[model samples]
Target: MSPTTDRTIDFTTGAPVAGSLDVAWVHGAAGEPNLQVHHYDEHTVILRQSKRVTYEAPFLFLLFGEERALLLDTGATEDAELFPLRATVDRLIDQWLERHPREGYGLVVAHTHGHGDHVAADAQFADRPQTAVVAREPEAVRDFFGFGDGWPTGAVTFDLGGRVLDILGSPGHHAAAITCYDPWTGILFTGDTVYPGRLYAFDFPAFRATLDRLVAFAETNPVTHVLGCHVEMKRRRRRDYPIGATYQPAEHRLELTSADLAAVRDAAHAVAGRKGIHRYDNFVIFNEPGKADQLRLLARGRLHQALAKLTRRN
Candidate 1:
């Protein structure tokens, strides 16, 4: 199916509107530098820290607001002394701020979840001026969004000047995973919950509940795009890189449709009690059990066995 809106794939190969992001997307890691920027609009820019630098291939989002821009998910590498992600961000922000030099715009460095791939660069933004790094701790994120002291998750709205972001605390994938809804663009950033990759369910029940909440929330809201942090699916569909594979060739699009979300919900509910991998046309959903289950799953192949040992070491 064609995209509902002009997205950042092969929609074009040229410049976009003024104060808007270019639709050009990033390709492979070879010859690609760090912090590859894909402009979506004046207010939205998607930054990809190449897999060559970080194997996770995590996408960091930079959202510009009248007050300040909010950065979601720092890259996996933590060499601030060399990489200096904050400095790269500042350089881009400097150019963006030059457009409206008189207007005051601060920065909020936040993460989608506390996984090492997403929050590895948290240290870089800790002491930046006019910038507050929301603690990776679940409680700190909950407090900042006023979700209260709950075990599971809840919803809250964060006002970023003219933009109002609906924050859905999604636990299950990770204890502090979140889904950020940008009302201005009708985009739902689902972190790892519904990404086009292995939907790793560390907690099956929590993941199911979160998907239900997201479905209901989308029912009431105008959601056109379900954007996730990582892209592990091959463009050919039903294919993905092996576990821990660094470079991705023929990578899938960064965005998923609501129908895709429903498919995920269906698969998740179907595999509610079962613990294994469920392959789909566009993605794969895997429910990870405990250590014993991991070893059992790994017994199938020497590669899997070696991966299990490496995973244990990490």
Candidate 2:
């Protein structure tokens, strides 16, 4: 599906509308705000940090419920002056409250994984009232989500009032990685584990298992779209932007489908013993890459940066 601008939502039935996601998100331009917020629906907000502020430019999700809101991933920056994530989130909550008034409404700040770029802004929510910022460690995540003895094995349900999410233990990119499925919207938020970018399988076995699980779960569920935290791939097939390239004018769309998930699983299975980058049409999977692989990626990123600078001068 393509990026949509029709953000009309039926609040009574809670049917989500396809919001505007086709616009050019922060392209490292001057005078842009640190964060960009988009409403996928009335109760669902998608926020992205500006690449100018930080190259990571990770995407964050805020889902409102009857009792509380779940803010997934704080962002890539910690300095509130630069990112202002908490302030921005507060304004969003207050605005949302005006429409759906509630007392003692709480906020649960969580993550897709324990990556630094995803949890950097956790400290900003520490002092906020009625807010519980879930710790980045695996133990904290498992405990808060009530993952029981199965730990990173079983699936659990988290009730956000009328909105209930199916939480699966998806550990590949990070040991604490999770894939949240929202029944209300039929959108699966699959963090860094599976996005239209580099799929870094630090633990290849766990990652493969997670992909298989996600595919199977989607088959039995009403999964409309598979959304991830970042967009790094270009519009071109089998190609990705350099690691640190900020201005992605032709970046791939953020939303992937269930078919894409299956494709990723099959591709990952095909490269079970591979130890390097496995390029696909939409995403690239790095299976147990070494330091040399990282260094090469960094070098390519630097080269892209230099080329961008030279092009600007000419």
Candidate 3:
């Protein structure tokens, strides 16, 4: 694995090559198979919230180094004890510690952006010893990373001992949104910026710039995978789950490729400042809020809920 050499696909289709990576779609504490846990090498793990929990099935990532472990974006789950997020994380940390055998391991809990779905489970990490939560506000994030003038556009490195994660300035989807590149695994974790779901660009210009930045970074770096938080797409291209669908069968894979990034970038560019949904090969870019569309969606959700209630009662 040289710096100049391009990284291979690593693994294709369903899963990665046996030992290098493996994903298990296990049941949450509530007995729903909505949580997906992935072992991306020995140092990194990716956990996803299933659609059964909510439509905003966010993904939480854990990166372990020699000194400390970093968990990114606690999913929209409110109960950590029931979800057992920290306990699950503790197990992962303990395993990492077996080899290093440190008396106390430090943990930093941070968010990709200041959105409810991403930071809903923040309370889980609040009281834990040796754990710190990076504030999600734009100013607080800038202060914590010490980016100052380069707040949203600058890059900073989080050194978890030997491992370093480079955070790229990513705004648009949200002011505090960021993209994390892991040199250890060659994976870029893009929060809500680009995923298989509805790509909402509250700030169209910033979103476009962020997409361009990602494309450029992928070109310069050997990015094996472009990982996002949610999987709203189906196995079929250009298709996605609608709002308020609790269960999705035969969903899309959780990872996107570099070529997918180029496609996503083109899609975002197509909708620059435009207020509508523009479809691409894998995703759709939305520029602004649509009141009419929102009303229709709300009506449909209520109708669906009414039908469900009747069926339960019958």
Enumerate clash totals for all models, in the order shown: 5, 0, 0
Kindly report which residue stretches of model 2 are placed more than 4 angstroms away from their true locations once superposed. 1-22
As for candidate 3, its clashing pairs are: none
Q: Estimate each model's TM-score.
A: 0.84, 0.93, 0.86
lDDT score at residue 2, model 2, on the 0-100 scale: 23
* Cα lDDT tens digits for candidate 1, 1-314: 23332222221223222333334444453566766787777668888877657657788898776677889998788887635688889988987766645345688888888888888888888788888898888888888778885535678888766676889989889998899998777788999899888788998889999999999888888777888988888888798665555556677888888889888999899988788888898778877666775564445444644675798699
> Which regions of candidate 1 deviate over 4 angstroms?
1-30, 149-151, 290-314
Residue 189 of model 2: what lDDT?
96
Compared with the true structure, what per-residue lDDT tens digits does model 3 show for residues 1-314? 33533222222233221224346453223576545677776667888777666667778899876667889988888786445677778788877666556656799888888898888777878898999888889887788767778879888887877677788889999999989887777888898888877788888888888989999999988787888887777778888666665555656777888898888888777766578777665887877658865675568767766775687699
lDDT of each residue in 187-288, candidate 2, tens digit only: 999999989999999999999999999999999987888999989999999999999987888889999999999999999999998799999999999998
Which model is ahead, 1 or 2, in terms of TM-score?
2
Comparing 2 with 3 on lDDT, the higher-scoring candidate is 2
Models ranked on lDDT: 2, 1, 3
How high is the CA lDDT of each candidate model? 0.77, 0.89, 0.76
Ten contiguous residues with the weakest lDDT in model 2:
1-10
